[model samples]
Target: MVEIKDFKASDCNALWNINRNAFRKSLKKESYEEFKNITENSIGKVIFLENEIIGAIFLKSQSEVGTFKVEKFFICPKYQNRGLGYFILTHLPEEDTSIKKIELDIDESSLKAKKFCEKMKKEI
Candidate 1:
């Protein structure tokens, strides 16, 4: 099962490690800075599978209404095919009934991520 909880500063390095493996050499130094910025925010959460941190998401409210924007969301490469990404995508709405809309930016260069986004649209 996957669980969501507050992301603590202590988890930054661990998150970096996961990011490293997921993106490999494609990751830049700015990604770490961005992670720090997001982790310090009141929003965002760490995803855990059986007590192991496998992913994290950064969220920001788009309005006073029920819209939310997912600034960053990812699952560790090692944990990807186990359906954890799908779980997170589904769990977001299940956890928040007030969220009438959700949005996220996906890199068009990544066919895999684009496909995942398409799949999420179908499921949602």
Candidate 2:
């Protein structure tokens, strides 16, 4: 089963490793710094399958009520294509009923991620 939990200090290293391995090209020094900044500054959460850490998400509340901006989100490369991402996207409302909208920013070049988000939107 997949689980979502509050981010703990102890999760730092595992989350770093997961992000590093998941988006090898994107986790360069500058981007890693950005990741650290976001994780430290935002509301962070960790995603797990069984007891293993598999992903992380960082979000910040937007100005609008019940709106949140996704700063970063990633599932470990090894854990992709297992319906976990879809589940997380769809089920977050169950975890926080106050969430009226979830917003994400994706680079134009990241076609795969855009597609995934689109699919999730359709499902929703």
What C-alpha lDDT, on a 0 to 100 scale, does residue 1 get in candidate 2? Answer: 83
All models: lDDT? 0.74, 0.78
C-alpha root-mean-square deviation, candidate 1: 2.4
List, residue by residue over 1-95, the lDDT tens digit for candidate 1: 78887778888899888866766644244467776777676367789989999988777888668777776677898788778877776777677
**Model 1: CA > 4 A from native:** 25-29, 96-98
Candidate 1's error at 90, in angstroms?
1.3
Question: Ten consecutive residues with minimal summed lDDT in candidate 2?
Answer: 23-32
**The candidate that achieves the highest TM-score relative to the unseen native structure:** 2
Write the residue-wise lDDT of candidate 2 on 3-105 in tens digits.
Answer: 8888887898889889877666542343656768788898887998899999988879999998888777889998888888888877776877777778866
Residue 118 local lDDT, model 1: 78
